[model samples]
Every structure is written in C-alpha cells, then in structure tokens.
Target: MTATPRTAVVIGCGTTGTSVALALTAAGTSVALVDDDPGAVAEAAALGAGTAWTPGLPPADLVVVSTAPSAVADAVHDAQSRGLGHVYTDTAATKDIVCAEAELRGCDLKGYVPGHPLAGADAPGRDDADAARFTGRPWVVCPYETTPAWALETVDALIAACGAHRVDLAPHVHDRIAAELSHAPHLIAAAYTTRFADSSEAFLRLAGEELQAAVRTAGGDPWLWGDVLAHNAGPVADVLDRVAGELARAAAVLREGDSCAPLELAPTLQEGRRGQLALQRAGHGRTARDAPAGGRG
Candidate 1:
C-alpha cells in the first residue's frame, strides 16, 4: 500500500467530509478542511475536525473531494489545477457519471480513484458528523485499468485510516449497485412518505414504529438525492420500474381481497421476508463488522 497519508485536504465541510476530517485527525494525520461556505468550515473546525484550508500551502499527500455527486467533476478539476494533492478520491455515491465527467473535464485519472463510503445518516444535518461514521463500513473504490497503483493504495490507506474496509469495483458496477442499494431506495422511501404531507397532527401522532422505520430514508436531502438519481437515472429507473410492477401486482391483489378470507398477499409477504433475511445474512440491517468487504465486481 502507498505510505499512509501524513497530510490531507478534504474539500467539503458537510457531515461526510467533516467525518472524514475528524477520523483522519484522530488517526494523527494533519488535515485541512475546505468549503465555499466559511461558516461550514468554521463549524467543522470548531468540532476539532481540522483547520480550514486556504491556498498557498504545500500539496497534501491526498485530497478527498467530498462534494455532492453533481459537483464532483468540477471540484476534482479545480483541486488538481491548484495542485492540491498527489492523489485524489471522491465520496460520491454514483461512479460512472463522475468518472465520465471527470474524464471529459480532462482530470488526471492516474492520480484519482472514485470512491464512496457506504455510511451516512438518512437526514441532512451538519451536526451529525461522527468521527466513527465509517467505522467498519464498506468503502468502495472504482478504479480504471489505467489508475496507478499509488493512487489506489493512497485511497486504501484513507479508507483504512477511517476504520473502513476497502472494496474495489469498476465504475459501471459501482453505479449499478448504488442505484439498487441506495439511490432507488431513497426515492421509493421519499415517494411513499409523501403520503403524510397533508396528514393531520392526530394522524401523524398515531404513527407507529413500523411506519417511521419504513420511511427512514425519506428524511435525506432531496436535492442531493435528486442529483444522485439523475446521475444514475437509467439503473435507478430500472429498479424503480421493477418495484412498481411488484407493488402494482400487490395492489391488484389487495383490491380483489376479502378481509375475512385467507390472504393472497402471502407470496408477496414471503418474498419480502426472504429478501430481508438474505440482506440480514449478507450483514445489512445489522452491525458493520458483519458486512462483507469484497466487491461483486
């Protein structure tokens, strides 16, 4: 692996970026946090994550561009132009679009690996930047065949320092899986949760744990999730279409059902139970330590 980063720059002060800074700082790596919003940087700095980064400093060992998915290419290009670091990576959820745009922008691909840490809160709050957010989480790195060993190793070291496991994948594979595992799920949750937009206070107050748990991801940043869905639209649409079909069939069955009769929804319910069991067996819906570190790609 490449030598552990002695110094790093994180080009965002949101939860994920601040969490990265915090983890790196705790690992004894000197970190510089940067963001266009000075208040955000100040907040992160106040949390002792890192000092605010300014121009004119020597190039860092690595630079983590933790911007929104849509802004990744621009951030990488700008940071590289300014000689921010020797190696670079990003924390965007989708990879294909990011890599394509980066290449179109003429980014230095050899020095960069596209990555995503599968860890974050389901809501948009700046104060949720826990240094242990990535602990034992699976961090995926999408590297091109041309990506240099040093760049990959540098990112591996970053993931390791953050207490995450590295999973290397191709860009297309990463995007496809992210569409299924994250982007589509968030959209579905938000779509379902919209039913409560006009809900009465009494109705909402009666909401049970199941209802809350079902729409947990609906609390995430819509703008961010929208950008992510747009970036991986094709894959996400495919997943959504399949889910819609399943739900439509279930709806049809419900429409024809008798309340006192044996439920015909047994098949659908069984399938869902099986899927959940499979996910649990795969270490999801549980502690991160049980998560597999290998990528299917």
Candidate 2:
C-alpha cells in the first residue's frame, strides 16, 4: 500500500531530530517530539517543532530515531517494542553496526528502513535546528532484504515532505561513503584546528577565511564525534591514511631546499582544484530549487 505519514513521532530531540520535526510540522504533518531528556524535548517544543510525546499517545505512521550512532539500535528496538510507529528509521551516521544490532535484537525488519540524512550542524541542541536543513540534501535509505515495499514508500514520502531527494544504498556502502564524505573530513578538520588550540590571541588574529573554512567542521562535540569515529573506524581509518599520505608527500616536497620551487607543488594543487570544480559541477549544497532532480548513488 502507498503511504504518507499523517502523524509522526520523532524519538530524539537533538539538532537533527528537532529539525526533522520542524520540517514535518511545517509540511502539515502532525509531529510529536520525544527524548530521554525531557528538557531537550521541551526545548524543541519551544522552538515550535512539535508537542512533547506522552507514553500513551497513539502510534504514529512513522517514527524517526535520530540518536547518536551508538544509541540508534537500542532506541529503534525500544521504539518498536513500544509500538511507536508503523514504520521506523534511524538517522545514525554508521549503518552497518546499527542495522546489525537491530537484527540481533530481533526488530521487525519488514517495517524498518535504515536511513541517514546527509545534513548536520555542529550544535547538538535545538539552537541550530532548522526546517530547511534537509532541503536539497541527499538522504540515504538502506533497505533490508526483508523490508516491505510499503515501508520504503513511507520513508520516501517522509523524505519528500522534508524537501530532500532519496538515494538508496547497501548498508556497508553507506558506511564507507559516510566515512569518506563526513567522518574522515570532520576528523581531519579537528586535526587541523588542534594547531590553533594553543595559539595566542595575537597569532589567531592573523587567521583568514581560508583557515576558518578548513576547520569549520571541527566545532562538533568530541564525544559525539568520537562515537561516530569508533563505530566507523575501519572505513574512516582507510580514508585518513590516504589523506595523511598525500599531506606527508606535500610536506616532504616543501622541506626540500630552494632548488625545489613552490611551483613544484602544481600537481597536488591542480588535483585539488579539479576535485573542487567537480564537486561544484555536481550541484552539492545547492538550495532545493537549484539542486538536480536525482540524488547521487
């Protein structure tokens, strides 16, 4: 059966979850917000995301569990046991471990679709949540073999309601891509920003937009990021190693005497320019109106 959730429940009240609630509520879908921390739920509600969910509220058409990576499986299992919704999805960065744990916990596979919205803010609270956060973003869905067609449809409607394009991927593929695109990048930004941690105010005054841009993602909570890195360690480490090698080569080349002119770094700079151009041509980070019709695979 085709589905569009008329009423939904968002099971976490952090930035991502609150943002989802805001989008859904703005779309005229009834949204109930919940969190283990009642204060979080109240904060989201204050932002007009949705009303706080009560224990005996009717089961929603869809339930979005937007907890951190390590808590996603447990949250999903618990939501299912409570008959929270007809179809369930989690917004964790790493999919394999969450999916595996859900399976191990005997969650009803047919009614669940593993998902991640490729949009985030460094803030963990509702301060940074926005209804437009997912607009034009590539929201991924990893359908299990047992996932029912209607369940997928429900999730598609949810993504569409939030103004996002849907991309389907295998669980492992999603994790690897998350590592390359998000996890590793954040780690690299943190590494780069660490240099400034002990810098004097006068030294930091000389920093420019380029330096700020390079370390933008470094503002995220370390505990949250640490869990994400730990969960996707293997894939993230692979990307880190490749990036480290490139930086090492660049460093080694620069260490050479004046005989090695700065222009000798042309190859690496050219490669970076090409990659940036390709990313722009692909229409990444565009508004919904400017984004292309389909999501990347």
Candidate 3:
C-alpha cells in the first residue's frame, strides 16, 4: 500500500532547516517553512522551499526542529502542544540532552527521532542552504526502542531524500564520537591557527594548503561551536585527557631520541593512521573494517 505524502513543517529556516525543507518538497511532501526571522522564512520560500511563517502556524504531518541544540527541546514541546505533527525529529548537533529533555517533557518519544547531519559548509545562514549540501554525507539517526516504526521510516526516507547516507547510532554513542571526531578537533584548530596569525608576514606567507586545511574548521560559527563544546564537555574532556597523555609521551620520546622514540611514538602514530583510514572508508561509504596495519618510527 502506498503511504500518503506527508505535510512537513520545518522550523528554524537556517542552513540545515532550509535544506531539509527543500529535500522534503522535492520528495513530494507539502512543506511549510517557519522561523523567528521573517526574512529567513521568505528567502527559503523564495527558493520554492515552502510556505513562510512567523509562528502559531497550523499543525503539520511531520515537524522537523532544525534549531540549535539549545532550542530543540522547546521547539519539540511547542510542536507537540499544538498537535503540529504526527512525527517529530531534530537536526541538533548534540543528541543526549535533547533526547532526555524530550522524554522529560512527555513529548511523544515514540514518534521522535534525534538526527544530526555530519556535513555543512564553512558559511552559515539560509543563503548557504543547498539541496546538494548533504549529498553523500553521513546523517546519524538515533531512534529509541519505543520510536514508532512509521516514524523511523519517515525520518529515514527524509534523510535519503537529502541525498545523504544514514547511520543508526545510540544518542550517547553519537555524542561521544562527535566529541572525538569533530568538537575536539575544532577546538584544537581554533587554538592552533590563532598562534600563527602573529607570526612574521613572510612566515604567514609560507603557510600552505595543509596548514590552511588543518585550520579551516576554526572558522566555523563560534556560537554554534561553543554550544556544541559546552553540551558535550564531559566526553570532550575525556578525549582531551587522552590526547594530553599521548602528547606528553610523544614529547618525552623526542627528548629521549632514538633510544625510546619509536617505542613511545609507534602506537600513537599507528592510531592516527587508523583514524585516517576510518575517515577515508566512511567517506567512501564503507564500514571501518579494522585498524589499518602499520607502525611508525
């Protein structure tokens, strides 16, 4: 039996929200784009994304909260209280807190999925929102056991409509991994990149593609990154401690020279190589088979 096309209401109209609305519309879902910013809503609707709205809009079949993690709980509650949607989902970067709040608020967890798209451009705003933004990228879907089967299917279908691949993860697991893979690295990049700015003009001139690429994420939206780091501070702190320990070991190895250098550095270097391989595999839509075989001198 063919299911009826659902009416999807996307709140926020930021980059992520606009993109999702476009994808849903492309998939034959009637969409209404809502945002506190009237201009943003108009821009998205101008692009044929959906109907623009300020608030107090009529209910929809699906309500997608694409706001910042901090705003997700309120958005979910508002949608639920208005009976706005049959199924609700969020595109917040952090999941654990949002999921907990949803459960606490007595929102319909059975029809809620916590989702995060693992891709975005350096720029922010609805202007940067593109249908191709999430193409071939990983979209994490964290569905609870009580999550309705229909809700899961609807969320998965929407993700696919965005041209992204879906991966199922537990909310806590997603938070931890996101901390290690994205949050910590962004923090480090923002710190390290600032150090080079005060160097001599010639020194800065000598900076190459590798250096630029390494620090690119440092240019991300500060408020967004700040919230992300704060929300996942505990897990991020654990990863940072391990990183600090490894750095100390590497420093000692360099001081000791050949006598113990290889011994101390081998594992760290190998782990890094394994991480690179895993990222490469993920990019190529392959499972992280295992650690790549190697050691370093």
The candidate that wins on lDDT is: 1
lDDT of 2 by residue, 1-297 (tens): 244579999988988899999998998889998898999989999999999888798889999998888998888888999998999998888998889988998888888899999884556547999998988788999899888888998899889888888899998899999998889999999998888899999999999989887778898878889999998999999999999998888888878856664787888889899998987766554543445666433
* TM-score, prediction 1: 0.92
Q: Return whichever of 1 and 2 wins on lDDT.
A: 1
Question: Model 2: how far is 43 from its true place, Å?
Answer: 0.3
How does candidate 2 fare on TM-score? Answer: 0.92
Off by over 4 Å in 1: 258-263, 284-297
Relative to the unseen true structure, what is the C-alpha lDDT of residue 104 in candidate 2, on a scale of 0 to 100? 92
Off by over 4 Å in 2: 1-3, 120-124, 261-264, 284-297
Model 1, CA-based lDDT: 0.88
lDDT of 1 by residue, 55-113 (tens): 78899999999989899999999999999999999998889999999999999999889
The residue-by-residue lDDT of candidate 3 on 70-168, one tens digit each, is 888889888888788888889988888888888887777887888999876555666777877777678999998888788887777777777777899
Comparing candidate 2 with candidate 3, which one achieves the higher TM-score? 2
- Which residue pairs in candidate 2 collide? none
Would you list the rank order by lDDT, best first?
Answer: 1, 2, 3
